[model samples]
Target: MPSMKQVTFRDLWQRFAELVHENKSVLNDLDAAIGDADHGSNMDRGLEKAVEALNASPEGSLRADAKLIGMTLMSTVGGASGALWGSGMLKFAAALPDAPEVTWADFVNALGAFVEALSKRGQAVAGDKTMMDVFLPAMVEIQAQLSDEESLPASMVRLADQAKAWSDGTRDLVAKRGRAAYLGERSAGHIDPGSLSSAFWFEALAGAVGQQ
Candidate 1:
């Protein structure tokens, strides 16, 4: 979700920044045991670079924004999630040529592109305990909710609801892709950090969508 009638590069950066700001500590805690202990730092750094890139160009072109996101994440963040998530955004951004005003179809295509790109890059799917666990199902719900929507805020709230469900659903899933997979059934007790983060981003977007 975005505030403006036409989403600019700045809006994308702001959405990401707001999510990161809110979740930095949570992500750091989540990464402490299962992962490298730098998820928050890495994502914050990546988004900072993304904003810098946004400022560098400031052209409001979707393509430019996409390329900057791709480059920034690839350069700043490490590990599987960084590459996969970064590439997903990049792939979606690449599909648009200019500062095109997006519609429901655009979000659908963008989410589909994200899952497809991450699948191709990571070879994972829903229930894999990866970000795809949340992304795939949420995307499905988003498409269904927005298939006939006229108000952007309404569709975004629907998307947020689905994302919340996806985040909650991750609690019972066993990790199959990341190092957490080694925990086997033990992973089932803890919520997937990636899904939580993804849902937070959606929540922030939804909160901001109607603000303007």
Candidate 2:
């Protein structure tokens, strides 16, 4: 596959920010059921800041851009969200080559590092009714597709669909992490806002890659 340009990569985050803004209320409502009811607003604030930071800088290497976004999010966002996305993205930046463009495999490999950082920091797994519910399975599917020699665009498109289904599947899960954990049995029957936002990230990724 041709290399993924830095511009397109940056657009992925922009698309994600837009998606988050569009669904802000829906995400907050979902959180209202089980958590602080601020997931959407928190993420929106962080992503918007992240995008602004990106826009303020001249185009840079993938690592530099990712690091900028991560650091900006760390400082601007609040709560567990800031820690998770900020640190995870830092790891993602560290995993990538310091180049203006990279292959799809490089992006996916860096994504694995991002997810690993999230898993370790959050200590959550597939059934935890958290973002991992989407990240874990999406990582598995991506690896499988890579092994099967799927095209990058095709794989990302499938990932967007699979992520939504995985996020929706969270509705039946009892929360085992975060504030929702306190609700125990009552946590079931509501979608996890974090998981849905993770789905949106993949949707944004697919759209960005498609444009490339």
Candidate 3:
């Protein structure tokens, strides 16, 4: 049987950076439809800087690495994504222990902190056509799976699928927050860029954990 595995902070950030680069154009296209058309470029730049910071000092603890990543992102990325995503990362990092690896429960706590930080920062709720649409449902599913004693990889796989579904479901939702809200009813038929990016984030996380 595949045993439970601990995830190193380096593994998590490396996968995230790779995924951001891989999906940059798609994220930009999704944003052009309803947002400022810079989500892809902004996130790419931020993650690149984050990866550089991580590579430069790989000896730090996970908490320190996460802090550097968050600070780098906040400084490098432009627009609301920088602030929101950076703040979320910092919040998540704050929730983690000062260790090189994390257990399933530790990851769940960090994920919950990230969601709460993003929600508070954006002041958006479910059905708002924001990243929250993807994140909230995934959090619920992960928590439910944990309660049932599901393996980490299995739970993450389910969370990734749920995030994708919720992201796609955003096409039917009118924007109630952020720049997309300016489009109002016009945003209904377009997928949310942030939600889509968030789906990729979870999918990459699932892939990383599955590899363990």
Ranking by TM-score: 2, 3, 1
Query: Estimated TM-score per prediction?
Result: 0.87, 0.96, 0.92
lDDT leader:
2
Q: Which prediction has the highest TM-score against the true structure?
A: 2
Model 1 regions more than 4 Å off: 1-9, 147-150
User: For residues 161-184, what per-residue lDDT tens digits would candidate 1 score against the true structure?
Assistant: 788788778778888888678778
Q: Give per-residue lDDT, candidate 2, residue 23.
A: 99
Return the lDDT, model 1, position 93: 79
Q: How close is candidate 3 to the true structure, as a TM-score?
A: 0.92
Against the reference, the lDDT scores of all candidates come to 0.72, 0.91, 0.83
Query: For each candidate, C-alpha RMSD in Å?
Result: 2.7, 1.5, 2.4
Looking at candidate 2, the ten consecutive residues that score lowest on lDDT are 143-152
Q: lDDT by residue for model 2 over 69-169, one digit each (tens)? A: 89988888788888999999999999999999988678889999999999999999889999999999998887677633247777789899999999999
Q: On TM-score, who's better, 1 or 2?
A: 2
Ranking by lDDT: 2, 3, 1
Give the per-residue lDDT digits (tens) of candidate 3, residues 80-152: 8899889988998899887766566777788899889998888999999998999898888876666433477
